[model samples]
Target chain A: MNTMNNKKFMMIDGLPVAIEGEKNILDVIRKAGIDLPTLCYYSALSTYGACRMCVVEGKHGEIMASCSTPPRSGMEIKTNTPRLQKYRKMVLELMLADHCRDCTTCDKNFDCKLQELAQRFGLKKVRFEPYSIWDKTDNSSLAIFRDPNKCIICGDCVRMCSEIQNVGAIDFAHRGSKMEVTTAFNMPIAETNCVNCGQCAAICPTGAITVKNDLGPLWEDLHDPNVRVVAQIAPAVRVALGDEFDIPRGTNVMGKMVTALRRMGFDEVYDTATGADLTVIEEAREFIDRLENGGKLPLFTSCCPAWFRYAEINHPELYDNISSCKSPIEMLGSVIKERAKQQETGKKPKKTKVVAIAPCTAKKFEIKRDEMQYEGEPTVAHTITTIELANMIREAGLRFEDILPEAVDMPYGIASGAGIIFGVTGGVTEAVIRYVLGSSARDHIADISFTGVRGFDGLKEVKIPYKEQELSIAIVSGLKNAENLIQAIQSGEAHYDFVEVMACEGGCIAGAGQPFVLGRAKPERADGMYEADRLSNVKLSAENPVADALYTGLLAGDKAHHLLHYK
Target chain B: MDNKELYQQIDEIINAQSSEKPIVAILQDIQEVYRYLPREAFDYLSEKLGVSLAKIYSIATFYENFSLSPKGKYVIKICDGTACHVRKSIPILDALRKELGLSGEKNTTDDLMYTVETVSCLGACGLAPVLTVNDKVYPAMTPEKAIELLGELK
Candidate 1:
């Protein structure tokens, strides 16, 4: 869409465009589709003009930066003259002098804009030998990895982390050739409130920052006969997985999703939502216990791993207050191993490999936590997020449409309407309150859901009068919001009895592991999640069959004692 | 404080900087208490802070504001933003160079302790020819004040 200020718009090589009032000639040229090649010029943010890649010849004799040079009334710009292209390619060659180019294992391999630009310029290799011999690949963070040797010094990660994520966990630390991105005191990201949103990875043009891939492990398990692999799908996976298969957003292919997993060689398919129901049971019971016993009043939900990690780093004082209950994925891993042992009777429990089909990239890290290891399932193995799973399914020649909807296997299969809300921001806290608030008041809590915490408020607060006790609850989604809330709590500014926090902005549906949507495409697809919630018949946690069965069969009346409550 | 007491104080400052980000601010504050960044002080910092010696060196070298070596009894800072640049602050810097016989990035001559460096906009553009001695700003500075300030150094 052209800005209204395009009245002063001009044609550049047959492309019509408008220029912002103070936009430079390079900006106008880029907007006009006259691809003025730039090395340091990053789109979607401010231009630093550190690399003179976008140098173009103006109508006058002076060579100017397309990024920094402001447009004149009638300036004729020459973008791809031989002299300019040569200068741009030479800039790449200089940047590549120290760039690590092992494309096969590179996280940015096929997706790298820099590599594509190099191919576009038809450059074979770096003309100059390497400089700055140090190659720093810090794997301290669970999700995002930074390899400074591959960085072109474009500052995209710095801009995205600071400008977009609001967590300037990274910045240019040193000067000139010795410059590298470092956290506070140059500590590893695990020591900071990084939140693992992967926005930095999204904005990075080179192989500098990338998400760690674990799909290879999932593939190995898929082919292993000794591994009894069971796959559980997260609620948000159903909403966004369709988009990866080129289907419309919010397509309920829950049945087909199950079928695809079976075809992919999984021994069993279960719903992570089933485990979500289990989570609701444990979480709700924990909430009620806190309310009655004067335990931590407003207990923070531990469903989101990134949020948990952030709290562990930023709010160590509140560590004891965090819900001891594992996430749906981790809970499912526990149940899978437990059931495998139970079913084997006197025989030794077979090694069960559990894979979580999640809507989050952070789930990849959650299953790897040391505390999550189950007895039989020595490794709570691989995870494939919605988009990645879709890619793998396609690579395997399996069509999601051909897959049939099958019910999740029992024990932890059923979940309540409240459990279904776990996909949303405050769903976990609300669901916990509905199911765990003791029998006398559970019915008195009313049929209507507490929708105050439902929407996308970074830090949402609500006070519920449950029976004789008032439960103070706060739901925080997004790491940036978590940071603000933690800081407030740390400084004694904001206080809450219990908090539900998810590290992703719009909760799991808008997770970093969700399908890629360009900047212009997000707002349109953003509301697709609310529609998914609306279409589900079961809206409350009390109504879930899985929870009912777990109570009646497994622990009898002590379901709350067995599964609902944890550290 | 003597050099050993100064070293102990610097150790406290560096320990704070290593364990917490908030502590780096304290390090800046202590730099005022002690005229310069002493290497012996960093040794105490390394022992207390538990940070690697190389890392402390890296951090010290990175920030242009920090001084790893001793300075003259006094320090001078020149603002090099657009406003100060327009005021020909270069002449004031040149005057310091002529007076101190310092030609490069570092200057350690005589018993005098002065480190002159440039900084970005300090949000005081109206005070164009501003120069800072210790922490106090001398507004509308002239080349004469640059020399006079050096003479007043302890």
Candidate 2:
């Protein structure tokens, strides 16, 4: 061991562990493979010592929060002492006393961290008297649900919204026992400027915040014979759907997912990536036109529903700068409805139900927006999260791992590698670049891969040379970074020809509706998406034969102009 | 105050500070003008300060001094600290609440004449069982005395 820089060592449970300037004792202990229980401790967010679950005894028998306490040299720490265990048990007991212990009915029943910790610590009973203080459940938002009773006042949601997304739609209100995470004047989340990102729901330790369930209507539509329920699965969902099963994180279950959806009574299972391919074609054309002629420079990609809503509410002046293109799922819905109805009635579709399975809760709200509809009927009728889809699969008694993988339905199912990468940040820009360069001056570009735009960075800036002119592109994931970029653009400090923004940190793969992993699963999931792209036969959107056929045949002239583009 | 005048006052308060204080200061000033923090004021501050509505609202609600709803003309606060609790302050609080017709969670009356609230401590421990009506203290208050004071205010 190279103990180069005055590295201190600490004894944790009588084992000497070398600590190299770690922030806290808890982190050091965690590094040593001893996973101390934490309720209010999120690695990304600020260390909130509100919950005393991570309390450990020091050398002098002083109880301190390990998360907030710094590791000192020659310090003796006792993490799992009987006294500390008793203290932690009492804390959990008190937390449970006032909590709504309806575990069977809770949305986060199996996955809730609080419940898992309690079970792990062998808490058989809570001696404290049961009491209920809060009765209000704010289901005001289209996506998020807030039950104040289940809240442990962890402040994770508050911090995540404020710090990570820069949209503090909910925060700690009042003080002490009366304190709660609520909107202004206890206003419903819908009334406030909540973008329906559902990050709060994703970070919630309990069922205090959860994505609104739309499984009932979906199930009804699935069972209905009159309704031709067509399912469109987003690229991100495939990379994350395996987490719901015992499958490891970042496992691509695309074929199995399609087969599972088909078995769950979906009339047709289509890929949202096909829609993404169409998006690339349309957006690239728009970008090229804007570059050649005079239009909004640095056109922002209008895909991530959460980012779209944030821009609309927070920065309406820049709305014109956003590309007037519907998201991949929305485009797929339009295609399915138009084509399905045309095939059925020899005219425009009247009643083809398009359901999208996505790794996003914001898609639920996006589908309900007025802009998302055509002729007063919503293009996407229903949006279900990946977790809900997994539940449906489990409910249907389908063995996801045991079942053989199947191909997706044709026409709307064929997609290129460019489309699959749309699940991660900078994918839309890269795909558009590939399409634009591949279509025009193909021989000039030697390497088709645009490695500049790919990564898990909050903000990425890249300049690519196309023929004579250089295209300046910025890829931003997370709304906070987007906010900064917007400010920079406004101040004339930065300029770009195109910008790709995704509200979630790692784009759709790490969406709030995806399976909740404690640590970030963005890098792994992004790798999985990249692997899918690598295996894809068609690397460019312009080269997709299905898209070419669609453009030349069904989506010819005014049909593509209407169905593919949105204002 | 008129919207223009209120906004002007808010602007002056914001400009008066050398460095920006926490949002509580702005909220407190707005509350001072309208007797409570108004939605319009909150929205204006949010726009001017470039702070999210949720952040401002959180700060407004966290403090006991700032009220989101319209408060009564005369606010009454009864001390319920350890000293006053031992000195039988519960009877005084009950008397005031009954007289004001404010029970349960209803701290403010329908007429908006009086609002009764309990404080952990008014920092008047020597004068135990103390109550204040719009900054005017009434120490060593009996139930009858508290009722008489409220009746006189009415």
Taking all chains together, each candidate's TM-score versus the true structure is: 0.70, 0.94
lDDT of 1 at A33: 56
In model 2, what lDDT does residue A485 have?
A: 97
Residue-wise C-alpha lDDT for candidate 1, range A434-458, written one tens digit per residue: 6655454345434325547666667
The DockQ for candidate 1, computed on C-alphas, is 0.09
| Whole-model alpha-carbon lDDT for candidate 2 | 0.86
Give the worst 10-residue stretch by lDDT in candidate 1 chain A: A517-526
lDDT of 2 at A320: 82
